[model samples]
Target: MEIGNKEDNRGYWDIVWNPPGERTGIFDVIKGTEFRIIYHDESQAEVSFTRTWDPSLEGKAVPLNIDKRFIILRGSSGFYTYGIYEHKEGWPDFGLEETRVAFKLRKDKFHYMALADNRQRIMPMPDDRLPPRGQQLAYPEAVLLVDPINPDLRGEVDDKYQYSCEDQYNNVHGWVSFDPPIGFWQITPSDESRTGGPLKQNLTSHVGPTMLAMFLSAHYAGGDLSPKFTDGEYWKKVHGPVFMYLNSSWDGSDPTMLWEDAKVQMMIEKESWPYVFALSEDFQKTEQRGCVSGRLLVRDRYIDDQDLYASGAYVGLALPGEAGSWQRECKGYQFWCRADVDGSFYIRNIVTGNYNLYAWVPGFIGDYKLDATLTIASGDDIYLGDLVYEPPRDGPTIWEIGVPDRSAAEFYVPDPNPNYVNRLYIDHPDRFRQYGLWERYAELYPDGDLVYTIDQSDYSTDWFYAQVNRRTDQNTYQPTTWQIKFNLDSVSPNSTYKFRVALASSTLAELQVLSKERKKDLAFSYLHPSFFLSNVITGNSSCMINVLAQVFFNDQDKGVPHFTTGLIGRDNAIARHGIHGLYWLFNIDVGSAWLVQGLNTIYLKQARSTSPFQGLMYDYLRLEGPCGC
Candidate 1:
């Protein structure tokens, strides 16, 4: 078993797996571990290596039986690897921090790495990250290559985390050796076994000339994504069967075509899922799995009275939880598929289990959860006829800022600071992934926070991608508050209005609302009324009470907020260059008594300022008048 080096104190480009001594970081190698031939035939063969844990070595080794398997088929160029992890009910309690298989190619031969069509590049050598060649940045993981072996790469920043990709797009990526016209790729046909849903971001190929098949890690999402077993709980999971694919061009024409060919092979493997060749009964075959088919339709009266086809909707089955729990769920398997243009979807080969069907449309604001649980018995073809989803809508849209597509891509994403850039995303579609973008907020808004006025401001250019803290000095960060100004032609004192605010991401932050009267306590303008305050209805209802936006009142001064999303989210998407994290929606209600016929300004305050990284990315925001209006 090849284990990685210590967490830190290791060289920049050192071979992470097995440095000097046989010192494993988190997982310990089992004693008397042996490999056994499961099956051997002219057509195919299967082999297994067993590592059993000893309770006596509880503190030393992971209290779980790790079964690693390898399979090879006739006329196949590459092999398949998978692992079965099990922790019995009597096993001692422990935390599983990280587990993965890594491959480090010969640096001399493989120099080009491809994560995606647009993300591929000829990378700098690991030595380029060492002193005299590279300069370490804010974190050890980031190194600016001052002088690289490939002079073209000089001044470019090389960070493994920079290449991290979401699980959905992480199907095939690897290193290319132009010398031999060969390609080494890690192809994950499906991510049903990986944790944190399809949008979960994990490390892919990086600067060590390293390619990782990440089964579990705390890369983008923090410790919460890492599972901890307590009181000897029994847990078992099948991590992979991910294919290690290899291809070569004999003609020596276009060696990069190997990447294109690897992509073709990836589709071949995906279509051959639930392989019937495996010897282990734990590995279910096609006959043992079930299928789900359905047609989803959306009924948003504001858009159209008739049911609209849920085009390009992400529909999936996950361990039963709340509406949006799939993003944070890690313990169970999840099967996801996009709805067709006609809103029809077929989820096949689902392992027999009880799951809740969850979905979110591309242009929709809220999530859709089927009220019932689905039971997938072997060979069961379950058809959930026609399903209609009515998004969270209570009234007509008086004013809407951005699209509610669970992404901040529509907002203004500033260009990365000239000093620090990842050339790949400069004018690229993923411009939001540039480094130090959070700091740009402080530079752009040097004096005051962003103030967007409806009809006058364009979201694409006016609204910033994220609401990050304004760095006051070297280490001090001040909380930021954005204002949305809109004019109301009339006021209805007896009606209730809905304020819908959807956040694409947030990191350990508190979003608050102070009463208009108490706004002075924080920082307010005596000329304008703000927050959820009574008796000061000069017009515009700026102070509306939201579900997650904590509203402070006179009697509840410094007490519990009327509504508080206490320290929500830990995905750290901002620092990781992720466009969004776990989705959050806060629906607030404003009474007619708080409104006036004039210009209204609602102050959206992000009250957390401990770290500059703490922030929020708004997916969309809309103020809706009463149902009839």
Candidate 2:
């Protein structure tokens, strides 16, 4: 093993090893030595041990200098750097319900130590209070990171932090700050000095050695998570019309099209825009549409890659195994582009061959060019030269354009004369004394001006506007609660306003955003209190439940929900786009309370049991307030 010299706050890095004696009978620490961070190069995944570089022991394991280490890691800074690790011959003694799942990533993990602060997230030390990871920790395992000042940081960084220390068995116990801070990082892990010993074994004597130590650490998801069958047409005929050209400009005016010029304008309006859609075996209708282009020459700029302006960043385009990761950005096998402003990119069409480009620019880390590999043939142009990268030294001068331009800069700025209009608009029969500011959701509440639709609504195909409930005792998932009561006469009602509750949740539990004047959970705000205990899953093919369209209101409208890579599938479960399904996290303002002129009730607590195969649902909810919403 060799890796030496990188410290000086580049997140510590030095592996170099040579200890391996004992061959006559097999016992040099059971034939293993340890130093984890794997994905396959040896399989058996879990192995985050320690050998302590003795930064006095930045992470612990000093008795006899176990392997002499130095691994701090921040993670997938941009499509993994030095990934696929696994040196084991051994390393897994400590307590054991679970240990290295985070930083070791794979749940679509992307770095920031597996997505910022919580680093590779997975605290779960359970009632023992703490001491599952490598041992020795009585206090000090809370250390947050990433406030090197907060310039936006995606996933929204800026964690509150405590500076990582970990001892009484949570293990890490030294040298904090390895880049943390990302939305209040807090791993309390308090309470588990269990005298720093006991646990010797349990889970039924490690059930046959923890199922042979999780099949020698390869992790088998038999608990069910289905979605590894692939072949959508063989992945649209090998990543069809192959796209992915970050930093645009080979010609094709940046609309960020490596693939998906709006799914090729809906396959050119489903076959007809001058034809040309062959994904192989000829789905016929050809006229040619195969493009690809590039250019990301970052000359040499470091203050952390010019503080990660890293030239328009994010430019993936994989295809050839493992392409369904990180929440689902790898859906259908990778294809992300956006490196314009000079990084240059293009993709008129695709379906070529051989690819792996990768690029990312948050704190400037991996793949500016660390193995981009490419090749195209079909309709022309394949220039993928120029990918020079070299950014990392205490990174983060401040970056983050991610999350779709910070949610299109929130309304991309343009409120006009807005202070909140559209005061009241009713449909359906939501009961609110003659309310009808002019039917919008198509009509449902208390039937005021009539627009009807719930006599047994079933509308499908989704545009994110469900009202569908096929009532098999409900849960064919459609309608749960949709209402609007009034009394403040439209405006001026005790001031204080911030209602942005969109909607969704075909019953997982507790989603109250009540708003009465005197009683009824008084002006409450609850939402997801056991969404089926973190949504149960058990797939062999038929164990689906993935909800992420939040907006349960009541935190004073700092409003957050934004997800929209578009998803809400259901021909009968299992077929997603940006990751699993049910996507559409609308702008959640969902109201915050204060309207009190007369009668006001905005309650929505109904769903408890419904199971259209349990597809947890919700629909187009853009409720704004002020005049008559």
Candidate 3:
């Protein structure tokens, strides 16, 4: 059979994939089997199936058939094109060259089929109708468009509109556009007619740069829509749920200027984080004395009520004793402000000085003394109490107190006299003692004094026992003296001894004696002497002696029962008799020998009615053996 001219590519043909050197045609395999036919148009497409035994193809040898095929593909330029062809019965009689076979079985069957006809008139698919993939494939339908020309439906419409006279995409494309980019408005301070003008101006001036940057970021990321700007009514409606700025006026003037004004009026609502600052004295005035600083704890009613004063709050502090002057110090603390709710603030880490705390908010006035004088000592913490700001007539009352001024005291004691081998004496000057309330007096002496006396001798016995008394009476007693007596014969002539006397009272009393003796009979003694009366002595009172002593001797024989004795008798009775006088004899050496560790106890009991004057007095007496020559 003769095939069409190799260059005359003018008809559509079905594609078939065959293995190398295979003789079977694709129709032979599909003749007895069922096959599906698919057709696509620029706007819509469909797929159908027919069995070999179906009635439509009963008498026909080639059962497959497709009618009215149409496919339109669109180009970037606003135009559509299509490839047209008509299929005839029976396969074409042509030899299958490698090149021809390759072209007939291209991987993209749709493209191969379109190009086989050698016609550039391919139908262009409508922008809205064509699926993202091939025309014959199943896919979702295009979204509907909305018109934006109507003022009432500007934001309400689904499809964006534009001027059709300009670019076609500008009109047909579904995307919103703004004349001035988002965050294009410049805010400024407004006049008195604008209530929140000052604040709006401040916020815009302070934080506008940051907000502008964020808006620019959103624009760069292809945000869905431009940020909307509003003021007064518009602001209340659009950003009512959140915090936003209120433009002073919307007369279509300079957007930047209006934005600046709006920003000033814009607040973070009571629910946002607070901005706090510290207040102190004017720098110029405190330049020499050094600046005073403290923290401010601001609370916003909308954000948090429980932790309103917990850091980040507005606080004011005045120097110790000074409350009127206020200055800005640090940003370490912050607080939120709200019109409907009350707030508390705490100012801490205050300079080591005095200060008054105060707070001010819209429609409210508050002041308090942070009487907390911070001393900046090691680990010192100062709590300036909670400062609450309430509406007028409901705020807390102010209170104040004066810190007292006082000084410390000084005292001294004189040195001991070395030449006199006597007890140390202490004398505090009358002037120094006058501040007795804050002063303490004490006297120190060696540990071995025979007797000690206080100048106030007329005091009660209780005073004597307690050993401390106020010398109210200026009268000085000569016996306000401590005494120590040394009997040369009682100690070894050439032996040395050391002693210490403590002039102490019942409060602080101690006496220690140490000695070295070589005499055949040497004794160390302490005598507490008193007086006793005797009835047999005919109205006579004699001295009685009470003694504590230690006796030592080299020879064992000399350590006898009579080694030490205490004699007691009336002077008159002693004088009446000669060498053998009437007296009571107590042998301490005998009693000590019979007791363990040579310990002895003695008691002298006087009978009742023994004498008219039965009072007792004690005297000291001593005797010792001479040193062997």
Query: TM-score of each candidate?
Result: 0.90, 0.23, 0.14
User: After TM-score superposition, what is the CA distance of residue 462 in candidate 2 from its true location, in Å?
Assistant: 26
lDDT of 3 by residue, 1-629 (tens): 00322432211222222222334423221111333334445643333222222335433332222221211222211111111111123332211111000011111111100101111111111232223321221112111212222233211101001000111001011100022212222111111111110111111111001111010111100111111221211111000011112222345454334333323333222212111110111111112222223333344332345434323233444333322122111101111122223343333323233334444342112222344543332233444444443221211111101110000011121232222111111242211111111101123322321232223221122011111122223432111112222222122333212111111101111111111222243332323111111111000011111221232222224443112212222221111101111111111111111112211112121111122211111111111122131
Rank by TM-score, highest first: 1, 2, 3
Local accuracy of candidate 1 as per-residue lDDT tens digits, 227-289? 777777888888778888989998968999999999999999999897778778777889999
lDDT per model vs. reference: 0.78, 0.25, 0.20
Could you tell me which 10 consecutive residues in candidate 1 have the lowest summed lDDT?
11-20
Across 130-201, the per-residue lDDT of candidate 2 in tens digits comes to 233222111132211122122232111111111111111122111111122111111212111111111111
Cα misplacement distance, residue 288 of candidate 2 (Å): 24
Candidate 2: worst-modelled 10 consecutive residues by lDDT:
207-216
**Candidate number with the higher TM-score (1 or 2):** 1
How large an RMSD does model 3 have?
A: 48.8
The lDDT leader among the candidates is 1
